[model samples]
Target: MTDPGAYPNPGQHPTPHEQPPRTRRRRWPWLVIGVPVLLFGACGVAVVTSVAGGNDTTVTPGPAAGDTDGGAPDRGPDFPGKLDHDTAAAAGATITRDELAYTVSPLEAVDTVLGSYLCSTVTIDNVGTTQNDFNGYTDWSLQDTGGAIRDATFGPDRPMLNSGQIAPGGRATGSVCFDDRTGATPGTYVVLFEDTFSLSTDRLAWINAL
Candidate 1:
């Protein structure tokens, strides 16, 4: 009673093997929006290469400890001849050449009448920037230890490191004498200074003992 041409009724039109399969355009929404935009563009190019390698890191800083040349103030190491008592320069030590600094003080025998004088108390200091000219008799001296050098004299009444001119930061005490006619015992002696007419030959020594 109900077989109207084996089921193709209700205004139908599905012919070609009764089709029903053509749905393949879903590439998971471009892999979920291209894997988070390629992991947020590789974490924004690794945060701009870690902030351009932390602004090209750099530090640099060295020389300073008795500095030299560029910072000048280490005129040590040079004990030429006969300077015992552990390489001279000690009685209140403070050498610094060319730019001048000196500082002796500590060798006071006295005994007058052209004999055991020794004296001391120098000072100098013109840390350098210009004017510098000391000459306690051509820049002090008093070697001994059998090397003989003695030279600084004329201490009219003491206070006399004469031949001045020491501006930049100026300073200049005095008293130098030297002539220790071998009454020996100021720790053998060694208070030289020599910087003659400068071109820098630097000499400074000072172990006239404690």
Candidate 2:
């Protein structure tokens, strides 16, 4: 027979089997912390991959210095010097600017309905390998001794300078007239010629004095 004392009271202390299962320690807390950690690690890996890919980007270069669509390199005018009467007569008042060569004859007086006008024969030769344009109305001007400037005008009795494209090594000639509103003599003016389409701002000039 077992003594009554040998078995404890059923309610005094519970056996392991009788105790409520250790409440599982709420493992959901660990799952929640671990899931966020795993997600953050994945995002870190994605950022690293994106940064690595950015290093392989390519860049294109621009056109080289002095490069042009035309075969010849573009250049400014090479002025020989300003020409006066004797030198102009000997040299024909010639000047080369960029790809064009200009020649001007001595000025002569012409009668016009508006007023007296100074006229000259103007010639242009395309010395470059590429074609170039010329506009007589806009490219020619006359400056008098009094520093007054006048643009080229039409002379009814004279053939006007033809404005158009000039092929390489080709030349054109015609008359350019400017109104003499100041009554200045023909030889007391300066003839100016420039290329309207050229990148250079220089003007070729000749003194009309004889």
Candidate 3:
């Protein structure tokens, strides 16, 4: 039998040097994921707003060709030096100029072209004592207002101006025709008659504007 005081000793109680079990702190992982997700969502909203704002602008186009005058017909003055067919020869006395004589009939439009065909009578008078050879075609060209030259083409229906020589104090006459279907615009066109086809002298006789 043991003593009661010795069996249950008070020295067995917790001392000041011993400590209770400490609770470990729980780590909060949601803060790390929530910050990155919020930043990415803000950037996504900004990109969508920028793309939606760009689609509201408008664009325009330019005009087509030949719209310089708003598709309107060219309205200008008639060509000069026009004469009646029957009165052309009778009026020669008044039509005669310095050296050569010319009578241009009014421009005639056979097709959509304003002045498609032009007929004229060219008379060369040898004023000098020597004989003069009057050349044609190569010495003649139709010059437009834009400084473009139109050459001649001989067809079954198209007649070329007769070219020949004239004696002293004598005269020669021939028919002149111009077809402006090709390379012709709505503007003034003049007949240029060069004395010589060579480059030596570019002596020209303008037959007025049409």
Candidate 4:
């Protein structure tokens, strides 16, 4: 009513309580900064977990590659038996104990004798001037690893080599049988030969592989 046309437009002037447009509050800047901080925090937690687990873990060791059960090999048939001889006689075929040259064959399998018997060809050469007497069955016997003894020529089985006499420089060759009836297991058996004259002298001359 009082000269309204001369007054300014109300829409053009902002009131004291009316604020300016906020310019969308720049949401992209906050998103970029906050996203990077969140990613850094996640990576830091993962690195810390890995390092802590590495220190707590324990590594165990294994046995040496070449270690064994800690035991000595058993003495067996392959081992050569003992011989009583001087240094001079050791090299020659003649044994000093009896002044004889003897050769024995490897044990043979035979089913003729009772139970189980091992046969072999034995040759004894009298290297001395005097005669040598031998009772193959009585003089030779089987001795197992347990030291159990079994007599030879049991029942009617004749000794392949019998009690006989040999002249000087004479060689006698024949088969000898050994009985394995002592229930001793087959391992290393010491074939002991004894001189009738010297009963105390028993020589472990051969080993039966069995």
Candidate 5:
């Protein structure tokens, strides 16, 4: 307190501990800064994000590239072949084409079955010793309710048919399909078997579907 002329002899700068007070910082500088700019940028980003989301929703339209057009699929060719016959005969021979003779068991149906279309089959026997040589015929004819005469055609083929192997007196039945009428309908069918060797014909059976 008594040092009149005793200032530190030379110019020594103030020590760090005795530095001057700092100027007061203004808080409004932050408010005046880029806050509005940042908010505007955020709004722009949100708009862009929404637009991108909408585009993502419509990324691909309709079906994928390999989608089927729902049109008719390709149909392969129809089968061109004959039917399989139950040729579980004595010899393990499968009867095919003209050589085939088919049969159905005798089935007695009621009036309703007779009135509708049906398939009638009967047993065909192989009676002869040797296998059949040429063709033999079993002619079938029908008399309907209206007195109309219809050929109970063989194999639904042309008139009388040829069978390759109906051994000598062999018997094999062929299918004759037609509607059997009710008793009131009045119908008749006769099956007659004929071969070249036999002058006499063999009458297999007569049936009335009605």
Candidate 6:
């Protein structure tokens, strides 16, 4: 082997003015590389958030859990009967006094001699094969509807036509009257009578002029 200190060294200490060689890697190379990737990820998230935030939201009504409207509504204090307006009106009518019908006839307009009340009469004829049902009870009235219903009266509109009973095959005449000669104007009146069942006579009068 050569003398220990005698072999020339690849590099020696430089002069006072000379510079030393640099290492290949930087001290903070990971930070410089990672910063760009982190910035790109942050920028992507911001863009997505902005796009979503720019939209407007609206409220919408969702479906009910079950179908409740399909059924009938609760109707209290039945006016005449259990049947609705269409069903009750569609039922057939009769003339002469029968056990199932009443003999209703139209009469001349009679002013309530008692007072301002005016009454229009309609003769009833229960032309059915049975005996008259209106015997002893007075449950007669007219569904006199041409305008708005006059809820104002002595009592309910029901009592307006309820009068003395008529026998079967026997003719009974009914008079529809409104008190004070008011509210009820000139129009069509449906003479309704029910002894066992119900019967109505279509007779109209110019009872009260508007």
TM-score of each: 0.25, 0.53, 0.41, 0.48, 0.29, 0.31
Q: What is the lDDT of candidate 6?
A: 0.38
> Whole-model lDDT, candidate 1?
0.64
| Rank order (by TM-score, best first) | 2, 4, 3, 6, 5, 1
lDDT of each residue in 141-193, candidate 6, tens digit only: 44544433322123222233344544545565544454534444455544343
Candidates ranked by lDDT, best first?
2, 1, 4, 3, 6, 5
Clash pairs, model 1 backbone: none
Highest lDDT model number: 2
Which candidate has the highest TM-score of all? 2
Q: What TM-score does candidate 5 get on C-alpha atoms? A: 0.29
Candidate 4 lDDT by residue in tens digits, 7-89: 87978876767887667676998899999999999998886664442122111111101122465221112333343320111
Task: Provide the clash count, candidate 1.
Answer: 0
All models: lDDT?
Answer: 0.64, 0.65, 0.46, 0.54, 0.37, 0.38
| Cα displacement (Å) at residue 32, model 5 | 99
Q: Give the TM-score of candidate 2.
A: 0.53
Candidate 4: minimum summed lDDT over ten consecutive residues — where?
57-66
Name model 3 segments beyond 4 Å from true.
1-116, 155-160, 182-186, 197-199
Give the per-residue lDDT of model 3 (tens digit) for 57-130. 11111111112267442211223332211111121222332334443333333333244554445556666567
Residue 56 of model 4, lDDT score: 22
Name the runs in model 5 displaced over 4 angstroms: 1-118, 133-138, 145-148, 154-162, 166-174, 178-188, 191-198
Give one clash count per candidate, in the order shown.
0, 0, 0, 0, 12, 27
- What's the distance in Å from true for residue 86, model 3? 32
